[model samples]
Target chain A: MSKQYLTTHTVDEAHPTEIFSVSPTPSSLFSASGSSALQIHSTTKGGFPLQQTITNAHRLGCHHVCTSRGGVGNVAASVGFGGEIKIWARQGSELLPQHEANGEWELRWEIAPTQTNGGDVWAVALSADESYLACTTSDGRIHVWDLTARERIQSYETGGSGTGGSFAMAVDLSRDGKLTATGHESGAVYVFNNNSGRLAYSLSGLAKSVRAVAFSPGCKRLAAAGDAGVIAIYDMERGEHVSNLSATSSRPAWITSLDWNDTGEYLLSGALDGKVKVWDVARGVCVATHSETEGALWSVRWLPKNERALEPGMGKGEMFCAAGANKSLTFYREATGI
Target chain B: MVRFPGQTVQETRKFEALFCILELAHEALLSGNLITLRNIYYQNMELFVSQAVVNVMIDSLASTLGVGRWDLNIGILLPSINSIEKIDFHSVKWVLVIEKEATFRTLAASQYHQTSKAGHGILITDANRLPLSQGARARLNSGSQRDRPTKRSRTDRGGDPVASITNKPFLQKAENRGVTSLQQSISTEYPEANHLGHEQRLEEELVHGVNENAISHHGAGDPVNSTMTLTQTDRKKVVSILNEICTGEGTVCTAVSMEQKQELQRMLVLNIKAEIQAVDHFGDITKWLDEKLCKW
Candidate 1:
């Protein structure tokens, strides 16, 4: 049986241009768009009102933003199209300036200027504790920065320099902080072992550009999708191409973003065709599909389920948010008793 | 066991099993059902031992048949007709050379050719293969015997015996009709855009029809009871209430346009009407209103 989601709230004019990424903290939701500023909305209140707007967060425009799932849930990371990465921490309902280290509260890392030209940093992800940050470079390099030490600790290269290097488009740090995976333009998904600081698996299957790579919450499986219009799931332990999730009759459009819910039972995917689909992992079928606009969707995220929702008879309701060229933030709540 | 060249009992058993599997595949193809090498192996798992063994048998079968494995139509194969001459071309008005099987299937399933009444032919080729040779290129460019016009039989029309017999373009015209029918069949089998187009149409209909229905229903009802039946004063009151509830709570509520305000009011009334037994609260009303606005 399929699931249903009703749009709970929509900030139609949330951003002047396209909204690329939306990240949820414990109490707030952060949305980064083509504009230089990052907008924060309070999820605890009735209206989800805009709490703060950090102007000039990215001079050119911010494309990706992520919040740490572990730790204090106050730390967030954002990367802009101008090749700059900034970390922000929430302080009593107010977000402070970027990279302002106050008594070991923040770590400052200076990357070598020559290594990254403009537009090199495409995607970024933070470790569970916010102690490490993983970012993908245009030349297929995954750089792991030790946030506490404020230094570059490990660099995993997909290929040698020159013609062999493929552009790394997406990166994700596993919840356990043991594995780091990256999706590249060459349709290669590479998983690295953090403990050994070496490449663990160079997965092959999809022959099209990979736009999104995500590790399941349990870190047992990894999902990758892109121009191939199919989601490829790999068994992390055996590093084998396990199965594919795709429509039976007609294939979906290019998948741009992917996110797994906290329980890891459902996977949320957004595509260039403007459809956001909720995939039931165990059944290997798409349970719900929602398309509100014709414009391509750049990001989708599931809001963390609070303790109140854990109680029985609530139907284990799930909520997710999607944003893209429509310039609106749409929230979908799972329909109950349907 | 009768030994055939350097073979052991195990090797002979493997070969016999492969032969049996190949016979089953041949039967399936003849009945117009395609089977894959993997499917064949899985069906006879105990006999085949591994997928690699089945793959080798398939290649051997293809070589024995003097055709490519894909040409046998035993699976969802990529088109392997490398050169245009390799395609058994018939005289048609238009030729469509598709590099991908998926695309060809999509186009074939669409009603595009049938509606347009275009005489066309579709040829699938593997783009990774070598290009057409000079001789094959010349044949493709030059017209063949099938392209030539032919005279029609005199007794068929019964009106102009001499004219019908002298008609030079009869065969070419007949070929055109044949091509049209062929194209129609191909498209019917594969329709490319119908699935997506139907989905998009349904979605648009739901979104637009629901909003319109809510608005029209609001216009005909009492201003107070039906939320859509709001007067100018009522609209102002609702907007003010929304603003107060939204802005005061630290939520960023932008100044909604006139159309959006009406939509919110219509949704409020619909929700209220839908759940008439329950006591309505400002929070519930606002939440439902937000959901309605986002639905558009």
Candidate 2:
């Protein structure tokens, strides 16, 4: 019940501008910021040393950078504020842009929103194997693109396309690659079947804007949080609202980001009040709260567990990193009394 | 006289009934569930004569526990909206007011806030035809008077001057100027490339490599520098070279030898990085080109 997470490291100046998103590869962390530079920091080292900086990676500045998890072959996809998507292939700690023989980086494919299209692409997610990419547009349309073929294979619409269509704020692809879930400004969470390309369930409960949606490790449950100030958990198998997770505080705070541990036992949330809370899902109670700053946290991610922790005698532990308006990446690990 | 000087039969019966109700309510609260006062009254109609008696017992129990009746997980039957007046709305962003019972039911059934565009607004309805509770009215008034903006700025927009300079033409001009200045500085610092013989020898070496099909198979088809089209056989040869480099294997004479495989991998990675940078640079320009073509 005490503070479960201890501040491990703080990169004071990770970005010259506000860092919007941070994606971790097996050995490195790639952060995209308001500046055009996409920086790679080595996670294997103690201080998370700056390994490389891809300058001018996004002319208009990058907003989101994501890497496929579950040993997904070191491929990453980044979305820039300029409405362009760039895919990078990792080789020896370097993320190189995919290109052709002409000494020019190839524009593998694009998801462009024209004046007549009535939608602007906002969020993107890649499959575990890096074979498929899913993105959400402003008009509540989710497009799944086949990376190998470089084409839009399927498009799922949430209806009300005209002025009524809500902006798709966040998206996540299931680890098994069978499902894609999206959260919208309309406070609706929709899950789609990747094979049939039909909506699996239209989840309801949270009425405020849903900023973040994530699938649990086993893919049996989905967690969503946003302006509603409470995290909503849905049973993925039955497509039913299971329970609502609320903080002990009577006053509500907008939740900006959510992440689940490897075992999915604890759900972590970062909110506008700069407080990061760990929720015990089974008990439906918040066990701990840590507030290090007052700046709103934009992104939080759980680092992949290392092999040493998997040893027989070692106790299970978890670590995560958070970044936002503070312009610094703070790493937190479970307090083990070391 | 045997019991006590102040304890009469009526007072003893009332105390017993209050104790029983408190015990039942405490059990319900301990189970982490809610119980209605009507249900408690029905459970022991003989002990408590009426629903009003059960409500009074619950209030007494709440006072004894030093908590509110709601905190004890007790709810009244058909509770009026006025009871929720004290519900906190300080952290809420917006409030939705509904006047019709049917409309409120429909909205509640569908979880209207999920589908409503209003972000994180509290939904309030006068379904019971009751007046607004004092607490609810105070919250509404204070919420409206508060000057806080509903949406938070996402990425430090006004803080950075460079981020505000989003004009494409101006950025392109600045980039060109920087490139020219860099070139001038390099030329002044290192004059070896300016020598006539060295420049000519480098060009001859590049031509010789192209003639031998060492680098031309891939470089000759560059859309930016070359107008020459590649034949099917040449294209096949180039694809084979790429496959060999990617797979780190070779079978025929066209394959990269073992000694050069590492060099080929390094070059491929560097080219990929450059190409990625180029794509970011031209991403917007390419979209403009597509728009122009579509217009035509």
Candidate 3:
């Protein structure tokens, strides 16, 4: 019921620019390189290093990347600046393209969002069962696609002009695929009730931009933050700011990215100043701060805990990974009580 | 407790000192000796503290002054005092500093004094200079970017004598309190405003005779000219540079070659000492350098 983590090792030379995105599979960790490519680093055991680099994954640099663990099947989705969304499958260290017919290594058609409002895709979140892929655009629009039918299923508007030169900062789908959460530049956090096909709630707390948002594992809570230097937590059902996580500094450093742990007990945040903080949700305090470089950190995530890997009758193991401004991916194992 | 990893020893000490000063100054300023409060502020600035605390103070003061601090874009000069490089200029408009002391000769040659005519920059150095009592507080009313543009009012005869605007009652009170605090120890009985005023009047008569230009006097071999007068813009610039240094902005890109690093270190000590000596109690840079940097 208790967990603590410290960065044990750092993969220093894995990326050229800051590692903006990170997704971990059972055998390897996938990262979107600063340049135009997707790289996979083997994290099977021991120490992990760059094992594969899929060059030309996109013409321009890739920004958002996501993966599903179970349900619909194990599938990965990545979005780049050129308005194309590409999906791939875990193939050891390299991602094999998932196609409808010929092979799972073929391109699955790139959707051009520029036609709708001339905005770029910023984030992608997969449903727990891998049946749905939800993405946010640069102009505060959320589009969902059903992976089973390979067709666009739903579209939701964030009700704000996202013209601050940044995309919709983040979007997340609930574990059961019943709710979709989105954060916008105007400091508005909107949640859509997927089953009802309507905007469920518009939450408020932050006055500056909202660069990151995440839904709690139970799907009842939402965390949002950005330039305000405070993380605002809202209740999904009530649509109210439940709690505010006060930041330590007053710099206009944006909270560029955020993620909730598998147990939803802690949250991870990356900032514009190349610093990452792990927050203890219950205590409302930053438990740890990581800063290896001076560049901006774009994203961070907790590795999915595997129950089977623990001893018989023991609990599941907790592990987390961080990637950002220094073009590197760092894996940290939860500290065990000695 | 959030731990900032790999914080340099010097940085940690400066941050600690800065936090202490900010917390203490906030409480002291509330007691209402405005002039003394401001002097206590300037005399306590360190390289790093300057960057971190100065801007915060500027912001706090701006709020008190009913001005938006961020909009006050100021210019600064940082001459590679000791081993320090660029003075942190986090939220400022411009910063001019030699990262290496070897450029000092070249800096002296340029018509630098003319460009900074309206007092647009503050110089930060480690070199020793004149006494603080002689330093001027002659703020140019029409100088700052936020100042209103008014028609030039003719003087009594020929040249326009810069007229004093509104008397800053708050600053005057603070200054009076500061002089009293320094000249006389805190008495057991709480000194009334009148008693403080009487003490201040006595000190002012003595201090008034000292011209602002007297503080610019250099004893001997001062590489950077001490006679270079600064405008309020220049002072704001110095504050910005200090803010940057305090916030770790100065160290962001400091992983230079080892050779350059050594030169930077020496220049910082020299320049910083020179600058601090120009102020008053802030001359205790020895404590920061000896206790912090030497340990590292």
**Can you list each candidate's DockQ?**
0.01, 0.01, 0.01
TM-scores for all predictions: 0.51, 0.51, 0.50
Candidate RMSDs in Å, in order, are: 23.9, 30.6, 23.4
List, residue by residue over A1-338, the lDDT tens digit for candidate 1. 88888887788879876788888875567899766689987665556788888887775457788886543455778876446788776553234333322222131333442445322666889888777889887667888888667777888777775333577878899999999999987889999999999889999988867889999989999999976778999999999999899866354576878999988989999976678999998889999999998766889988887554232332445778899868899888898886
- lDDT preference between candidates 1 and 2, better one: 1
Q: What is the C-alpha lDDT of each candidate?
A: 0.60, 0.59, 0.51
Off by over 4 Å in 3: A1-4, A69-73, A90-106, A114-117, A160-167, A250-252, A307-317, B1-296
Pick by lDDT: which candidate is best? 1
Summing lDDT over every window of 10 consecutive residues in candidate 3 chain B, give the lowest-scoring window: B149-158
Q: Identify the runs in model 1 with alpha carbons over 4 angstroms from their true place.
A: A92-119, A161-164, A308-316, B1-296
Ranking by lDDT: 1, 2, 3
Candidate 1 TM-score restricted to chain A: 0.90
- Evaluated at residue A34, the lDDT of candidate 2 is 61
lDDT of 2 by residue, A248-293 (tens): 6665666878888779888888876678888889889898787877
